[model samples]
Target: MTAIVEGRSANRVVAAAAASIAVAMVGMAYAAVPLYRLFCQVTGFGGTTQRALAPASAPLAQRIGVRFDANVAPGLGWTFKPVLTTVSPRIGEQTLVSYTATNNTDRPITGTATFNVTPESAGQYFNKIQCFCFTEQTLQPGQAVDMPVVFFIDPAILKDKQARRISEITLSYTF
Candidate 1:
């Protein structure tokens, strides 16, 4: 009888351990997304850009043509576009650009923006001081708003062999 009780206790312990492990695994899976995003933001992995606290003190003499592009997802019922089509900026100079989003539908709609820079290799050097991406925006019917993005192309781009030849950088955003 003692042996039988011990065997049953052992089985319970094993079952409890397995349950704990399964819960831990699920928790890790949920944590992985934000942690991976943090890693990407820091490393600029996969053409993901970074955020900066301040702009570079001095800009490089070389000029880079930056084009802005914006789009609203289908069924979003919103019109979105960059206010400025293009701007030539010296590396390290802070530039402020704006995008306008208008809701044409009769009901309020919310959207979040995601963005990337072209020439994939140049993403690491593109930094934004302030951006509206990732923030939830809600607009009522016939409502329009201008969102601004403050950014600078890191002067370090000039030092990168792969990015130095890039004359044009396109910032594209999708809602």
Candidate 2:
């Protein structure tokens, strides 16, 4: 009888431990996404661009071509395109570019943009000083807006052995 009682108590402890582990796993699953996003932003992992308040003080002599691409997700009822197809700016030089977005629906719709730099290695070197993507933009029916993005290619890119040879970087945005 004592053995039976002890066996039951041991079973309860094991069950409790299993339950605790399951709960902890669920919590970690919930936390993973945001934590991963923060990690990518900080490290510029997987093409995520960095944010900065200002560009490098002095621009570099070598010029790099930057191509812009814009896209609107299906069902967003929005038209979006880059104002300029491309620009050649010296490394570390601050450049301003614009994108146009128009609302096709009768009701106001809000949009947020996500951007990335191609040649994934170049992501760490792409910095945005100001961008419409930082906040959600709301447009009324038939409303068209010109959104600006100010950015620079960090001179540090030239120092990275893998990224040094990249002559052109594509910055793509999706709304």
- Which candidate has the highest lDDT of all? 2
Off by over 4 Å in 1: none
Which predicted model would earn the best TM-score?
Answer: 2
The reply for model 2, stretches above 4 Å from the true place, is none
Report the lDDT of model 2 for residue 154.
95
Question: What RMSD does each model have against the real structure?
Answer: 1.7, 0.9
- Which pairs clash (backbone N, Cα, C closer than 3 Å) in model 2? none
Candidate 2 residue lDDT tens string, 1-175? 9999999999999999999999999999999999999998988888899999998569989999999999999999999999999999999999999999999999999999998899899999999999999999999999999999999999999899999999999999999
Candidate 1, 1-175: lDDT as tens digits = 9999999999999999999999999999999999998887887777788899787678878889999988878899999999999999888998999999999999999999988888788889999999889588999999999999999999888889989999999999999
lDDT of 2 at 10: 100
User: Which 10-residue window in model 2 sums to the lowest lDDT?
Assistant: 53-62
Q: Alpha carbon lDDT of residue 45, candidate 1?
A: 74
Query: lDDT of candidate 1 vs native?
Result: 0.91
Q: Which ten residues in a row have the lowest lDDT in candidate 1?
A: 39-48
